[model samples]
Every structure is written in structure tokens, then in C-alpha cells.
Target: MTDSPEFKDEESIRRGQEFINEVYRKMSRIAEEFAAGEINRAQFHRLYNRYQRQIMTVSQMIAESDPSGWETAVKSDESTLHIRRQFEAKAIGLSIYDNRTGMPIETIGDFSLDAELIVPMLSSYRQATAEIFQAGVRSTEMENGQWLCFMSGAYTTLIVLFSVEPSSNRIMLLDRMHRDFEIANAEFLEHGYTSADQLAYPFYSFIKRSPLDTQDLETELDE
Candidate 1:
């Protein structure tokens, strides 16, 4: 990383050294979370990439002030932080509803946001919007910039509320979770009536698998 004339002072380098410690410390939290099974690989990569980009910008400054300090800065950064988790979009709520009666079957996380966002739209959930949802997971932007995403299943609909717009990758993961949830409880879900206790919570597995490991999603290129 070459210096671009901005961070070419002793004071700038000193401040940068301190800041990089904080940044790398944040990275350490995610790294530790990934290792401890608190977060999955995809979530780690998404968050780590965001912070790593900042490293690049800071690298230039460090180089401008003292090229030799770049390597030291890296060593200081990879050291994990003991502080609390700082980043990653919040999984605010998750809800599962009966397709036939449009009644909620189960809910996890915060779904109060759902009551407000879902109720008014329930009336418009008629035939007109049915086709739009047939493809895959669909998301609606909330007033506070949050995202309310839902995927329909054979007998139920799974909705996830997030603090940010879920990425296409995350959507794909939710689709898999929905399919697995339906398959695991197909007999129960397809039956005339069943209670939530009798069914398995495959969607909850989504937290552990977050976007699912890339390798887990891979298949042979050919036979």
C-alpha cells in the first residue's frame, strides 16, 4: 500500500495505529463468533469483508506515514478483540403462518413489527399478489428502512424481518430453510390440522447456517 500524500505525518501515523487496533478488534469479534459457532461462515464473510475494506483505506495512510509499520499494523489487527459484537444485520423477527387460514403458527425473535406491517397488507394478499410471490422469497421495505421478507411453502409461509435489506445470498438461504421446514414436516404440514409442537423447527437452523456454507451449497460440475 503506497502513501497518497494525505497521511504523511508522525501524528497521523500514531492516530492511525490506534484506530487500526479498534478496527481489527472488531474483526476479531466476528472471527471469534464464527469460530465459536455463534455465526455461520457466510455471515462472517459478509461482515469481515466490510471491515477488511476499511483496512485497505487505512493501509494507504499507514504506508504514507511509515511503510515499515504496515506489517506491524496487520499483526496488531488479526489479534481478536475481547469486546462485544459490533456489526451484522439484526434478525429482528421470524414468523410462520398457516396458508389456509392466514393465522400465525409460530414466531421467533421480534414480530411486533410484523403485526403492524403484515395486518394492513393481509387484505391485499389476494389473487392479485399471489403470482408475484410464486417465484421465490420476496421482500418489502418498511418505513424505517428495515426489510420484511416472506417465502411461501406448501402449507405455510415463512417471514423474516431484518434490520437491513437481506442480500440475494441470504434470500437463497431462507428459501432452503423454508423448503427443509416443509419437507421435514410434510406429513404434519399437509395433514388437515396440526399443532406447532408436533412440527420441527427447521427454519431455526437458519441462524446456525446463516447463508449456508458455500461448500454445502455446491454440487458436482457434471455427473
Candidate 2:
């Protein structure tokens, strides 16, 4: 069998590793504070959600070696609304929708799709879905400098579109998307959720229950 593609040179890999470690350290500190009750549940949830997003972003950066990666990142701001109750102090806008039914749960911002955008997205989804059906490997596509679509299985697909150019590495983008599907699928299989609504329930519950208390927050000290 052919060997896997070698990553960048040792120095680059080391730098990437250092950056990832720093992020992980920060996440770990937040997680520890959360576990210790130094930070309330809402604060912890917000930090965790942000941390997860950062992990995905970092993974994409490592995979693509691109500095301007956030442009292509899936707009999780739309997902944050569901968890607003958990940390009301933070400004988060994330809306979750049923991939099949097109129904939205938490409407934080408009992730609207026009005909021009939807047509190509659906087409790419279809092609990727067909290929996955035949081959076990997933497929993704980037087109028109604005959209990135991934299809892994009959029931699993992710679409990220941007209003501007994406500075993300293609391979890393697919890797993170694949990881998300794996987690979501595992949860669905364990719970027997037929819709994305069910899959998003835990997050929604967290947000609704965890609204942040700004009164408890201390003002930042001047540097």
C-alpha cells in the first residue's frame, strides 16, 4: 500500500504542535476551573463550546497550513443560541437546524441559503453522498470561493459557506467535519434520534438552562 502523505517539515510540525498544545493548555485550565466549580455551569459550557470550535479550527489549520482559517469555518455562531441559557453573559449566536426538515430550533442569526447557493450545495451533497455509498471514504468539495461541502454517509452531511474567501486547508477542513459526524452519529446511534433536532437536544438543553449571570462577572483589570 502507498504511504500516507508526509506532513510538513519537522520545524513546521513542531511549531504546529506547540500552538496546539498552548490551546489545549488553555482549554484544560478552563475545564479544570469548571470541574472545581470556580466557574459556574454556564461559564464552563461557553468555554467548552468555544474550545471545541477552536480545536476544529486548529485541526483545519494544521491540516491545511493556512493562516486565515476562520473564514471557512462553519458558522457555529448559529449553534450558540441554543446554549445561551448556560452562559448568558457571553454574546453567542448559533442556530441549529434539521438537515433533513430544514426547521430551525434556536434562531440566533440567519444562515439563509438562496437558490443560487442551495443548488450548488445540494448538487455537491448529492455527488458526495453517491460516492460515499459506493466507497467507504467520505468526499468533500470547495467551489466558487464561497462554499465547502462534505458528505460522509446517507444521513450525514455538513456544509460550510462563506461570504468571503476561506483561508483554510482543504484536507484539515474535511478531517474536522468527519470528526464531528463521528461524534454526532455515535450519539444518535446510542439514543436512536432520527432527526438532527434530536441530535442537537443536549446542546439546546444546556443553552436554555445555563443563561449567564453578568452580575457575577468581575470587570477586567487594566493591563
Candidate 3:
């Protein structure tokens, strides 16, 4: 893949961070307006979500430019550090859907973030937003302390449900996963393949290996 021109050097990274901070400033302003009852909840929610997507996209762009730099920057920033803990995933999977038909065509997960949650998340998005087609992230509070984080791309979506244990750093992770999905399934996604059996066969094993299971195995080994 060709390198992105936007994030090529230290200067570019600095500019990206500035843009991200500006986006956060807007988010903070929106939050204050919501709290003051100047803007209703719907407007606040929509604008807040848009700003979030902007931050996530910009961070991903920077990370793609300099992964190590992005890591250091995230660690230095307290708010980003906090966010890093909030979006930690227990399991992650890539799923494809047909935007034209509004049907989920394929799912390849065997973890807690099941196929069942997709439609509901999409339904909630439709109910909550004016734009049904915009690709973005959504989170659903599951029973107990788990949260299902959904990040959508062109006609595909990535589902990552976080563990009940406290964790952080989801937005960038979701973006990376979405990018990987694009790279891994470029042909099928481009051609509009709708068969689950055909498209999911290769990734089935990946989705079945939950990150939580790896943690459990590590704990057992330590014990």
C-alpha cells in the first residue's frame, strides 16, 4: 500500500495532534452545551459521536504514519490514556453486511460479541441518528459490566466487546481492525460477495480465538 502523505514526519504528526485537540475542544464545548441545556440530548449525542469518529480517524492516520510515536503520544495524554482503558476488548470479529439490502451477509465470531447484537446496534443507530449510512462506532451496554463496541466501514463492521474487567484504548484498535479487514478481504469486499461460508472460511479460526481465552491461559500458566 502506498504511504499516506498526511502523516509522514514529526511536523505532520504535530499537526495531526493539533487537529485532534481541536476536535476534542469542540466535543468539550458540545458537552458543556448539553449540560447547560442549551442543546438537546439528540443534538449533543450526534455531534459528540461525530467528533469521536473524527478523533479516532485522525489517531489512526497518525498511527499509520508512526506507530511508536502514536503509542508514546497516547501514553502521555491523560484523556487518551483513559480512553485506552475504556475500549479494551475481550473479543473482536469482522462482519460484513449488505448496505443495499440492510442484511448481515456474513459473521465470523465465536465470542461474546455475537452476531445477534449487530441488528440491534444498527437499529439503535437508526433510532438515534439522522444519518443511517454514515460509518462510525456505537457501543451497547451488555448485562453485567461488558460493553459491545461496534465500528463500521464501507459495507463491513468490526465488533469488539470489552471484558468486564477495567480496560482502555478501543477507538484506535477498532480502526486498525477495520483496516486489516479491508486488506484481508479487499477482493470480496470490493466485489460485493454475500456468502458467509465463502467469505468467513478463512477468518473463522481467528474469530474463535478470543483474547480473553489467551488471558485465561496466561493466568493458568502463571498459576
Candidate 4:
């Protein structure tokens, strides 16, 4: 284990506890199988390796959020359409797709730094979502940091990426974004969109005027 700071704020402590709980949740199941002789050492290592990065990341983030060693990240606006976490300049990116065509209709915010890593994960998520939708799951949350959220409409799918650990405020904002998208595009989508550009243009205006501020989150943390 890496050396971490001795002092952590209440929120940081809570996050650390969450990380520990998640570790137990994942490892306990595999440990049971191994102890019962259901899997060999080779299979055990493979299974553990699959989740290692995410688990380690959660640990690392807990350390970084400790006040004694690292700065607590604050969120800020990167651009008119981009909001970023304090640790890095990367901002949460947004995308809309035609569920039937699987073609991207529009994208807001830059995801270039981690685009290579993000695209394939997004693809896998969408595929899983398609299968699960038949079972009445309209939306599902994935990723250890809650960094990505997926939501689907009648004909459109929405993907949101957070460069930071997502907060309830951020998720609530996304809910509003989804609602506005449906209202703004309902007529065009009902009658069939004319073109991708035409369908996506309205969203630009809506998002620009919408609340993407993270000040509320920062204030909550302060309390």
C-alpha cells in the first residue's frame, strides 16, 4: 500500500470508507469461489487483475483528497460548454447518439486526453444498455468513480463523462439536461430529425444557457 496522509476531511474519510466497502464487495465473492476450490490460482489472478486498476484508482483518489498531503479539488468552468475538476483541466464531455443508427449526433466538450480509453468503454456500455433496456432499465450507472452515466430516450442515447468524481449535484444537473433535451427536440424527433446538424444545433443553445456550475458542490463540501 502506498503511504497516504494521516489527516482527511469528513468527506474524504467517507470516500475512503466507500472504497474499502467496494473492495470487500468485489473480493469477497471471488475469495469465496477460490476457497471452495472453484477456481485455480491462475483464474484467481486473472479475476483480481481485471478490477485492480479501478480499485487502485479509488485508493489513490482517497489519498489525494486528504488535506494533509494533497489539495481538495474544486470544480470550475473550462469553457462555455465545458466544466472541469480542479485536479486537471479535463472537462466533462457530453454526447448524444441516434440509438437506432448508433451514429453520434453531437458532442460537447473535449475528451481528447482520454478519448482513446473512453471510446471503447462507452461502446461496451451502450451494447450492455441495449440488452438491459428490454428488461425495463432505462438508465444505469457504471464506473468506480461514477465518472460516466448513460441514459436513453425513445430514439436517442445520452452519454456523460466526468473528469472528476461525480457528486449528487452534478448528476442532478445531468437529469435536467436530459429533460431539456427531450422537451427541446420532441417535435423534431417525433416527426423524424432532418439532419444530424439540425437536430444537434438546438442543444448547443440549451446547454449554454443551462446550469453546469459546480459551485453548489463546492459549497456543500465546505459545509
Top lDDT: which candidate number? 1
lDDT of 2 by residue, 1-223 (tens): 7543454344445665676677688778877765554554555667677767766776676677764344345344444445433443321222333345444323322345554755565556566556565433332333542333333433443344332222223324444544565476666634446554344322222222333343433342322
| TM per prediction | 0.56, 0.31, 0.41, 0.41
lDDT of 1 by residue, 97-204 (tens): 888888888887666763766856553553435767565566777888777887777788787887766556567777888888888888887874658778777665
lDDT of 1 at 36: 64
Tens digit of lDDT per residue, candidate 4, span 28-106?
A: 7767866764443444555565446445555665667443222222122122122111322122566776666666776
Clash count list over all predictions: 0, 18, 6, 0
Q: Give the better candidate number (1 or 2) by lDDT.
A: 1
| Ranking of all predicted structures according to lDDT, beginning with the best and ending with the worst | 1, 3, 4, 2
Q: Which structure among the candidates has the greatest TM-score? A: 1
Q: Model 4 off-target regions past 4 Å? A: 1-91, 113-123, 130-146, 194-196, 200-223
lDDT of 3 by residue, 1-223 (tens): 8666544566667877887899889889867865664543445555677677767866896777563355455444435324433433444454555654667665555443454756777666645543665545676667776666666666565555545321223355556666676677678777877566455233433454533456665798999
Give me the overall lDDT of model 4: 0.53
Worst 10 residues of 2 by lDDT: 201-210
Alpha-carbon error at 122 in model 3, in Å? 1.5
**Candidate 3 C-alpha error for residue 48, in Å:** 28
